[model samples]
Target: MQSTKLVETRGLTKRYPGVLALNGVDFDLEAGEVHVLFGENGAGKSTLISMLAGANSPTEGTITLNGQALAFSSVADAQRAGIYTVFQEFSLIPTLTVAENIFLGWEPMRGPFVDHRAMRRRAHDMFEELDFPIDPTAITASLSRAQQQMVEITKAFHGDLSVLILDEPTASLTDREVDHLFGFIASLKERGVGIIYISHRIQEFQRIADRVTVLRDGARIGTVAMAETDEHALVEMMTGRAITEIYPQIAHTPGDVLATAEGLVTSGVSAASLEIRAGEVLGIAGLVGSGKSRLFRAMMGLAPRLGGKVTLKGQDVTRAPTRAILKAGMYYLSPDRKAEGLDLAKTSNDNLALNLVMGGTGVSRMGFINWKEVRAESARIADYVELHAGYRPKLVSQLSGGNQQKVLFGKCFGQEADIYVFDEPTVGVDMGTRSALYRLIQQLAEAGKAVVVISSDLPEVLNLSHRMLVLAHGRISAELSGDEMVEELVLKHFFDESGAKA
Candidate 1:
């Protein structure tokens, strides 16, 4: 007999005025198994799951639950049918408390009034069960991105779920939080719930996934058992090409120091010191709350530096404003792209033009912008970052995560800056996009520009950095170069207590 199928889709298709987002895709999930949808951004993974979660309706084909046809009119309808989805873009209201958002629609009621006490108690129990530390009374907006992610997961757990679809669930989670999430998924599997997982991290597939489905350009390429496939094969299936090296090796020819910080101190960072040189990649790595990003933010004047001396090309910029620092030939790319990098409501070309105008790159004259020159320059920068020409006229929010990241990366080329700092540059990007970004970093260094990369991804920093600094508890724990940047040694430094004391 055939194994139990929890959910199935046949000939699924979605189309818009000028695009076919998903095309005739067939997929299924078995009970108690993790079925991962693996693909590059814009490969129709999100479109397919959106349909499954009732966020969108398909133009063609049918969906079935337990061999019976079903149609959901809204996300609530899907939830009532025992299907819950944690989308990549959060759905929680920022102004509400965690408990309020968790039980927004289906609140516990007593007689004619909502029983808020019961709701908070239930939410607290769910968090305790999942081993997640979050206050039910806390305002949702005050939580970090990772904590908000846990809130989303906790909200889903409040429902009676037969199908749980998680879209890039661990994108903002730390290693310990990831472990808790994986354990929770294992428990869900034991309860015979079907899971549809979507993520760009290839290394995570082997840990929880039992089956894999690859999509490319809105069509399903193939499906295979996870046990039978390797990373190389999955990448080739997703990109339709071989990526021999995900990280490029470049010549590290260090020159004069372009930027330096001595005794850097911020609200999150303690006494940290480092140097960024021309023609080399400097990497900073640490765990969550380790102050890896804060150090650079303080040096760039984005954060309040309590005590520090920062210099750019021998000029003291310790108290310079952010605008002055940028005008002085230094650019910093924030890790939280949605909040700090791009304007979601604007077109990709418009965002790139904004950078050029800020850098005084002749895209504007006096008080008026030169639209023709801006478009031409934006197109050139788009090509350099491998952003599709078709996406230039569309809003940045309309693009996929990888393409949006490309737009942000392309902004760097629009300005004439000697120092480029990228924080968590490849957070939610696919392997192909990561490879492209890595090449761009390599090109920048070869052109004699100073490059600094701060990331929580240990492997990425290890492979890309010419010199690596490990941050622990807001201080530099260890600095390694050449043969000293191995995984074992770097991981040990991540928890070095000696670095914690000022």
Candidate 2:
């Protein structure tokens, strides 16, 4: 493949307070190829891309395009220079139509007013060209993650994009949607569009990467052709260790049922029933909108149960509110760390002690709480989860995605809940952090704490769960235990059990 250099970075460096996000590193991208960037969370993968996409100005180094040095002051500057970035979190407005979101602030105008018809027509054309069926007039909030992703990608293509940067593009997409996205990317590559892809899922590299670059501790570890390196070698490069087994699910006998849901129904779920037992992980597997999350939320009374009962610790909590359910020694941890899980604006110590500080009996007669106790308790949980102590004082917003998640785990560790419900616990975390979280989960089960892990990653559920429950269209399609828990069988229920219903 003979291609000219489209973008290049020389001795790139980024410094933030005590952190060195990116070291003096040299990187380059050529036209018509997919170059994957791999690293653990906080490994500078995003930092490097932020520089390339002009989201951040580098404290040091130079950027070049077409053999000429270039500097970008803002995202608009990057877009004008033919660079666009699609972030993991969306930028679409919930109430606006798809076309409205596509154009955003720059609507197609006729003299002094906006031309809604022309904008919708253009959006429809872009969707057709990508072989996707996203309705331009559909509400942006009503579209599925895959459809929204199409809108985001189209927004980039709407511009004269010479280079595209996608961060965790397939994180929320189903397998079918993933195939569609891959094909779309292939077409972009054929058009001489240089794509910079970043993902924690190593399996994705095998599908789309031409060349893979590994970053460790803000420095380039190595760059290798995708055809030449295996997943093992890639993991070894990203983490300075040879991880023989990523999932070390220790075998243990499950104890008595700690929590039970009987005919539970929620907004997304029609009817679901299951039991969570001590010393075992009850795995929940389903596609997006399949009600796996709703089932858990309903179980904890987070969502109103229209009918049926949830017996937690032999006590009926069907009518009990979420606060009471948690008081009953059951806790629900949201997979979304930023919104529902932790306060990104607060210090890690505050986020860690959020629950205890409010719920505990440490308030003084003058209404002054015990600060030392909170700090000690927070530190202990952080140490157990392997989070850096230096990060305890930093705002959660400053920590990496993986560390912020650790803070969530730390909160649960302090509470010592009897039944722990984790939804997509390892979504964007790196391979090393994943292994650590896996161990922490196994340890919890071994300690006789009941666990339920709801995840889109089938491999994660199959490995950690003693029993698996596959949901489809708000119903339990199949329940597998012992030797019946395989990926093929579990996924079959995700489709066959759900059928084509809502």
Candidate 3:
């Protein structure tokens, strides 16, 4: 049987000020095949898919589907051409029911009335096809992370899409949910739908993908048959590095207990307890809603707390406000940068200076703002992180993903906090920038600062953490150190009942 090309892009080029996100790159997908897209964050994978999905236009490129050139002036245009894309961030309407979200704008009508029954039935049918256990009538706001993703997939399935793009679909999914998704992809392939799967978990490529395309620095490195490659080779191609060493070695030892939490309780988890010492990197690993975020938020004083003792350097700060915690020389970098970390509409200098002003530094108390100090700080950190950009005062929204992340890190570094809480600091970031971040973190620990990293990436936690805690159902289930850092050993915590399961 001959393969049919479903989607193809040629000479794709996209430029944003100082960064060329995609430069003269080509990518092609075939019908009935799972095409795995691999890149080390900021390699233009998202940019290319956004162009194909009609979310954004390329500066230069030709996108053809089924041998016909297509121009997506809007997302509707792409949808009309049988293309669907599910971003890493869920785009479903939270207030709507699952059925309503699935058939949002293209509802089947029964003689001038919205056919609610028909839509629900169709939505249920879509779930049946994927064998996903999701209630069609459930409000999207009440669903779990994996359940919400199933709705997103069902929407695309019902759309009868010829090309389906899934970005990091398994990032928030449980092990069982991941298995279900892999099985669902096989069913999609049997139905002759061309699927593009993007994920950081290189292990999945072997199981689900037929061919793999690697992108690096906004260019196509190479494409190879999945049958002919291994994970090490794939890593080498995507990053252009041997990757013999995946994690950075922990150098600093744990010193005085910098922070401690006891009896922390939230809607997500209960009886949370943790401790971190100065110069130590402590890691919290768990599935979403397993209480990691809630614990961090409680410690930072963002969420409502119920019976908890939070101490910083043995000082009882259980009732401290978020500002008080920050004032006491502790800083938190949230996982969601666009929503919590940066003011996207503001200039880079303004974003960096807000930290200083919030802490009531000398620059604020002088009754006269010094623009040079702000500019100098931003410039110095920007240069240290190697963000090669013009000092033209650009909005953070105008910067690339890696540069935006650098700015976010810069804000926290300027605070000179004694204890740093980093929530997925390297999320959606490239490998080069990630390496730089690792070095920056190590240097911080070397300077006698305690760092707590809450991440879902197992390799990252094992690589940087001197001590690590695994949370299951909102409670600390396992603590691993030294020889217990291997992937299989750490993953056991994720699945184990009491560190006894495989």
Q: Could you say which candidate leads in lDDT?
A: 1
Instruction: Please give, for residues 1-502, the per-residue lDDT of candidate 3 as tens digits.
Output: 8889999999999999989999998889999999988887678888889998899998998999999998899977898798998887788999999999989888999999999999989888888867878888999999988899888877775555899999888866767788888888888898889998887777678899899999988999999999999988998888777666545666876789888888777777677777888989998887665677788888889987788789987889889999889879789998878989999999776787787655444366557767677667767777766666563278988876667888888788566689999998887775667877887888888888999899877768877898888888777778787888677867677765543211
All candidates in order of TM-score, best leading: 1, 2, 3
Clashes of each: 0, 0, 0
TM-scores, one per candidate: 0.92, 0.88, 0.86
State how far residue 191 of model 2 sits from its true place (Å): 1.8
Give the alpha carbon lDDT tens digit for every residue of 1-502 in model 2.
Answer: 5669999999999999988989997888889999999999878998998888888999999999878899999887898899998988787898999999999877999999999999999989988888889899999989988888888888886678899999999887777888889998999999999999999888888999999999999999988999999888999898877756778756677898888888777897876778889988888898877889988888877777987779988988889998898888898989888879999899988887887676673558788988888777777778989989888899999888898888888888666588899999998899888888988898888888988899988878888888888888778888888899987778778886543322
Ranking by lDDT: 1, 2, 3
Local lDDT at 315 for model 3: 89
Error of 1 at 47 (Å): 1.4
lDDT pick, better of 1 and 3 = 1
RMSD of 3: 3.5
